[model samples]
Target: MLKPVELDLSELGELAQVIPGPEPKLELSLSPIPQFGAERPRIIPVCEPSLTGNELKYVTDCIESNWISSAGHYIQAFERAFAAACQVRYGISCCSGTIALHLALAVLGLQPGDEVIIPTFTMIATAYAVTYTGARPVLVDSERETWNMDLDQVEARITPRTRAIIPVHTYGHPVDMDRLNALAERHGLWVIEDAAEAHGALYKGRPTGSLGDAAAFSFYANKIITTGEGGMLVTDNEELARLAWTLRDHAFSSERHFWHKFIGYSYRMTNLQAAVGLAQVEQMANFVAARRANAAYYTELLKDIPGLVTPPQAEWATSVYWMYGILVQDEFGLTRDELRRRLAQRGIETRTFFIPMHLQPIYYEMFKGERYPVAEDFCRRGLYLPSASSLTRQEIERVVDTLRDVRR
Candidate 1:
């Protein structure tokens, strides 16, 4: 049975008041989805991709053309379109977002024992990618306000071994790229943006991916513009792209087929994936609009609900609201996990924030004494609600009402 909702318009006015002043930036983009509200006005996944586009058409064309492999026109088209959209000069498609990061480090020739700064609150893939290059991921705590890397903590961590900084734009919100970039420029370090969760988000009126030296994106099925399972690395440096192109295809030199100039893993994105990705990119603007609207509605409905801290926006950035996350304050009478269980019983699916990299089993021994209070606290209290691009306004109300019911 569908529950009727009383829409709240009053709290919405608060939005305008918080609208960021110009420090710099612009836009949010479109994406894919999986509806979990099946059978019983059912479960709503934490994030879903909106697939209302020419996805089928373009994919069918690739199938008909028999170019489902890596070699095809769609590859170039997707690369060009995504690169242009991000205001970068080149987009080198890869097998996954993790590989995209690996490619960035690989091209920079990150040798063993080199250090790459990263936020502890990010997805494991960020750190894993650093490991892929035999480099150390120097983890830092997130800032409490935006749940992004604490830039102040970064400078102190840099040593002679530090080579790059990979800032995962946490939860679709842009990090303080200007400050990070300034720090990097001072230290002669590279900035690699792990923009997997932020496709069309902006910082200071500019796209996030372009703010760093090399940006990595994921086309996972749940991303804004998905290719089911793919990733891309965009940059303005011609030599870097050249190196990546060769690296993506097993390090083969252009002059010779099957001859290896260097040892490289095959990280190429298939033509079929590119075909779907092109269609998804074509619909990005609309997708971003839907996501923003959905997030706004969520904010409106949950405004008066005390003890819940909704996602915060920074004045210097435009968030994509990748997943409508909230932090359950201690006063809330329920633990974050407890609330999630309650929502699960109501057929609402939610996801907890990342376990800080320092706490992960694989990295525990490596970071035994290191502690990041902000990141650890978020891990304990943060969880995102249903934030699929395909979510409806009514669905947002249901999620809010259900949450209210849970608290009651």
Candidate 2:
């Protein structure tokens, strides 16, 4: 039973104005892609990249300059820009968010049998990254308030082997970083932010990436700021950044071209991707603003709906609302899946929340009989609405209207 946070009506009204023109129709003809014929029903996507920026021009430059591989100027430019946005000094660009997490942990020197604490409610990438370093990911249930790792339970799981704690800002809501940092410091543990979905989020006015020892961000097609398929590790630690940059490109020793000092990876982001990333970075502020505005309006419209729990933004956190999620309570008369199916029938796309790590088939046997009540509860009830930054007010209204119609 998570209590909803109070929505700031004044702020909501102010931000809602940022949304551009009228609401878009729920339908989108699928004629553009040759795969889907024009007959395909127009569906409002759950998430989509807004590429109205200089993505094309930057990409064309990369191609013309013959620097489209991983070694172009755009890569460094994108990295620096994104790092600055996080208020950090360094950014190590990588091929994907999971790789960024792995690189961060690797630089921290995680060893086999070491344990890293993480929320069971997060995407599997967090756990997988820890596993990549041969370190075990110790699971913690989520707190109801922020739907983030329960800091209260974290201490109980810390043991001699616990070396780090990866705090995931669930659904773009910043976790209580100060509290988590204090707890980690007391235990002599490193704090790594799993900020893959929380671009531009703030915790007590500080950017999320700068709050931890190191943070990972995803630039996937559906993320707040996309590079099509890329990620970055932002940090203030020079040594960590240096090591990650080296390791991401096969750890080729600088002393000699062919010599290798450490086992490394081919986790490099191409300049082509960085081109798009820089374009996206240039528009990150607007993207974040749009997401916050959309979340505010969605909350306002959905607040009156029975059994629907809109996402929460803690007083100290300014959530980017990466995906505008809602929890379906038992009183809703319809199960979460039922609501999703009905939404789909109306040509609206939706996505279910992440299933906890303990419930994942790959990790099931390892965590057999382990019950993280809060994470499991979220999995059963949570679903995201259309949450793209490109969403117009009319589009949001339509989505809300569909929810109301289905509930009836």
Candidate 3:
């Protein structure tokens, strides 16, 4: 049996200032049970993929051709098309976004006892990918401006053991990649962009997947593009691309039938998944446009709400706004969770921000005394509204109206 790690309160410092006190007991019901005679509103999910393209056509072709497994024309087509969208030379399709990250790290040849810097305020998979390589993940707090890894703190965190840096473009907002890349170059480190949430986000006119040594994107149902479930790693590095393609399929030696050159993973994406992915990628531009337009509408409506902080977009970034997240300040008159509860009761779904690596139970012991003030604040006050690309103006208004009603 394992015991909990003892938290060091003194290390928390300013993080303690934003703790939001003790959490009240949560209502078990996500939404109120509909009254006997009441008509309940339809549930608006937090995110849903917009698949109004040739998804069915491609999938039907896959079935008719009997190319449903990993080896099929759709696999290469999806990889090529998506890579072109990123302005990259190659794309390696994989089972999930998590596997894409792992594949990229494995291609970089990260070894145990090495270290990789990552944003503490990102999806847990970013950290998990580094851990998968037996490399230690060094965390840095996020910057308030872009809600991205603070580049200033990155330099201080770098050490002789640092082999790479994985900067996530949090919530579709591109990070300050120019600075991050320069810093990594100065330190002689590899840079991998964890671009799972940023399908078409741009930094200085370049797409997210083209901004680093290599990048990964998720095709989960909730993402801008969906293949039911899949991911891809894109890059301009030919060697890295070839290595990843081989490793993703278990690294079978080309010279011999069953001989293995290196330990690899069975992370291949099926042709059926690739067929859907190709169709999704075909409508990538339209999906990105819809997401941006929806985000603009959400910002326009929510901007004047007191204590509500709409997501930020730096001057150099064109965020796809994957999920329209906002911070609820004390002036909102309701805690973030309370607001989420009220919205739930009205059949509107919302999701809280990432709970930071330091606060995660699986990582608690390793980062027990670590503290990231900004990440803590975000976890406390942040929650994303329904931001599906398919969301309509009426739905957005309803969600916002529910938010206003909660304050009232």
Query: Which clashing pairs does model 2 show?
Result: 23-394, 23-395, 28-42
Output the better candidate (2/3) by TM-score.
Answer: 3
C-alpha positional error of residue 219 in candidate 3 after TM-score superposition, expressed in Å: 0.8
lDDT of 3 by residue, 85-174 (tens): 999999999999999999999999999999999999999999999999999999999998889999999999999999999999999999
Best-to-worst order by TM-score is 3, 2, 1
Candidate 1 segments exceeding 4 Å error: 1-39
TM-score for each model: 0.90, 0.90, 0.92
Residue-level lDDT for 196 in candidate 3: 96
lDDT of 2 by residue, 1-408 (tens): 976533332433333222122223443332232333345535789999999999999999988889989889998999999999999999999999999999999998999999999999999999999999999989999999999999999999999999999999998999999899999999999999999999999999999899999999999999999998999999999988999999999999999897998999999999999999999999999999999999999999998899999998789999999999999998999888878877777778888888788766567666766778888788878999999999998779878987897788
> How close to the true structure is residue 366 of candidate 2, measured as C-alpha lDDT?
68
Give the distance in Å from residue 205's predicted Cα in candidate 2 to where it truly belongs: 0.8
Leading candidate by TM-score: 3
Summed over model 1, clashes come to 15
Q: Please identify model 2 stretches exceeding 4 Å from their true place.
A: 1-41
lDDT of 2: 0.88
